[model samples]
Target: MHASITAAGQAGPRLPPVRNLRATTTQAPVSQTVVLEWEAPEPGLAMDHYVVYGAALSDFSPSQATLKVRVPWTTHLHSGLPADGRTWHYRVVGVDAAGRVSRFRGSTQVSVTTASRGLPRIPAGNLVATATSAQQPDYAAEFVLDGDPATFWHSQYDPRVPMPHALTVDMGEVRPVTALTYLPRQDGEHGGTVTAYAVALSTDGSTFTPATTGHWWALDTEGTFATWPATRARYVRLEVLAGYRGHASAAEIGLFEPPA
Candidate 1:
């Protein structure tokens, strides 16, 4: 390889960087793990080491290092990563036999989600009413975030109060929201469960673009969470498209960052 490189008139001791670093999931009947794979760097470069840098959403900084792992340049797979239902970011770099590091290559911001990380809920934010019903005025929207799951907000039963009832929340400032969890009435009955809903995001609370849409079963007493790609926004609107048992109620609404 050295003779060929010299013959080709290339002069460099620094090895070429790795390319296409990614995580591939594999199952083995009873358990599963992630396999980080990559394409070898350009030929003729005598690579001695390969390094991987990774980060999670909560403490990641592109400008500074977070975590590091190194291996020999002879192999391409980094296996046995636990599947804990978390999203991860990764990159790769190469080093020459002389210990000089090559320029980083492949995706510097490649993101992956592992199977073991469950839906991670962050702190809830300020709640506000966008549309309200006048029928059940005592069961107001403010009751949802007041920290009591026993109490709930039920849209008015009046025909004029509108069908797809909604409530918008402001996070106090712009933030990257990755998942949302909606708690049901929590009384073990489907008196006012959200059957189908659409969620929207906005920066100024005036304009919104739909982000996620899904349904919940009347028997989903524990509630369910829906996730979307991480998006930066200050306001979130949960539009209840359908209701069960003639009441539109929520015990709690949670916002979460993408799992680590």
Candidate 2:
């Protein structure tokens, strides 16, 4: 039963922009993709959505001509971008139901450079995969290369296998390998997503040399790229050193050749 009228020309409260925005890039077969992630401001307030802007310049203004997309979530993937070794700039701002937009600040912007053209994806059918353990029928090792993110390869659960699971793939012939792509299970649960890993290469499958080793983002759901100096090998091995919940799983795995 009580309402107060505001004075004319007085500005209303505006939503605060997101914080700690960061970008991650993954090199696909023909193109490069960037994933934008940010943390919502503390004491979350309701907003209609966020507008993402992209341009060739970092200090460019945000307007209709540079606007790229409107999303309701805190993460977005910019895909199908040409791998021309050009840097791309991005900015995001929060918009409320009243059409009032948050202040455009430099802290909310990020930049990523697309890699040069790379070799086409190696044929999945040409790969022969084997794993240390598999859930069987439902979550088998072969599923990782099926080209479907909907399915995944999970370690044995009935016996409850522990971490340090390994997956080996034979390319059927020796070829130059420049990178490895790992796509975490996208079904929403982070139970078995890999956290730390190591990759090895082998020509006779009996002797392998460690190629690269690193840790993936905690609970990362997007594709993670691991690159190293080009090496020729017929067999590739992935060793999972740690997982989110003491388990290991992957939706898809791919190998890439050097840029041609």
Candidate 3:
């Protein structure tokens, strides 16, 4: 009548939360883009993936309502967010194969503010663009002012030019420029997307003065805005300090004028 000895089942190893979670946001043309990055936890059982949660409220809890994405890597780019000048909060958690999830708490949360969607873009008909280099007849500099978001200006690739690529546009005449919008390549390709940049204005196309400098979120598919005090310049230059995949490209570059 005695029962055979039974072996107890062991539980899977506990996984720890990610560390050094960081975030950055970019105010894009149609939305706010957020880039989140973090370091993996101490070596342990492999994780199936990581879940990203986001909300407009700082005290929001991580749940199905706030779930943003599930990724297998340490970095993620969340786009198409509302650009209503509100602070966005984000959290990340790890999940194992057995559906075990890491703890969700304040330690892994980060936040960023979305900027207002600025003025409308003016016509680019009267502008002419030139670049430091070009790939060929296919991706020349003139495409940036052609009013076509499908075509773009790509830097030289045959010889494999280095970074710091420059694209200059003559607005036909010196007009009061309040802001500039840079539309990234729209073909879903990540290469040649500007990350760090500096904008300068020149009245004579030779003498230039720095207007503003900043960084755009990497792999952002929407347009980026750079504002400066109303400056009169015939030429505007977009200097690519750094770009994704060590290349530079732009679909369109347009300027904004003060409200009439």
Candidate 4:
């Protein structure tokens, strides 16, 4: 007797199809510096670039949107924005080389404010500079003087000297200073070296102790530049160690202080 086996088989279990999901944006609450981030869709899918959209919350929508320039990654930092007390809306999308675009992933809102305006206010203070002399023939070539006579160095050279000279300004009282800016001598050949410069703290302008010391280099032909620091000082001094070869020239000086 020949026996044949009848074909009897059951269908395999059906599985769900993989969905093409959009990416999402992960950003912190509104701040001066906004950090926008997102995640990849799948393990093997490559993201070629990202597009960021931002607008005022009042006007933000899918059809009406402001697009930032496309970036190469999923994260970006938007900084130095105006603190106008307005809420901003942001969204991100991912793009691939195969002309495939991921759905919008992340959304956020942020607020901005001026760093100085937000700080506490301090009592009004006086800025004084004392000088020994106050006479110069070439006013155009010499540094402009703007300080109290008791504490600042005054140029006193008579008109006989055609070349203008440099002057020192003693910042009176120890106060916090965030930035110091100065103009270099105009005559390129008269490039002088700053022998010693310091931010000092003084109860009285006459007595000054160096609080901070900085190395001085030759200024470029450009008019002026600035130095920034994290700490504050009461007084600042720039001593002339050497002068340029040609007629001397100097310009105004300024100091920037953060709010109390």
For model 4, the stretches where C-alpha displacement exceeds 4 angstroms are 1-128, 132-174, 187-196, 215-219, 223-234, 245-249
**Which candidate number would show the highest TM-score if scored against the true structure?**
2
Report how far residue 158 has shifted in candidate 4, in Å. 7.7
Tens digit of per-residue lDDT, candidate 1, span 47-164: 6666665544423332223324566753334344333344556666666666555554333456675553344444544445444452456667766666555666777765546577
Q: Give one digit per residue, the lDDT tens place, for model 2 in 128-227.
A: 8889989998999999888766689999988899878999999999999877777777665677788899999999999999999999865565457677
After TM-score superposition, the amount by which residue 89's alpha carbon in candidate 4 deviates from its true location, in angstroms, is 37
What is the descending TM-score order? Answer: 2, 3, 1, 4
**Candidate 3 residue lDDT tens string, 1-260:** 00110101113444567778899987764457888998666566576677777765467666444567778888899886544344667888776666565656535778887664554445678888999988988999999887666789999989899987999988889888777777777665768989999999999999999999999977665466677888889998999999889999988777776545
TM-score per model over all chains: 0.50, 0.62, 0.57, 0.34
Per-residue accuracy of model 4 over 147-241 as CA lDDT, tens digit each? 21112222343433333333434445555655444444332233343333444444454565554545434543222323344344555554433
lDDT (C-alpha, whole model) for all candidates: 0.61, 0.75, 0.75, 0.40
lDDT of 4 at 155: 39
Candidate 1 residues lying further than 4 Å off, grouped into runs, are 1-120, 125-131, 134-137, 158-160
Error of 4 at 134 (Å): 6.3
Q: After superposition, how far is residue 78 of candidate 2 from its true place, in Å?
A: 4.3
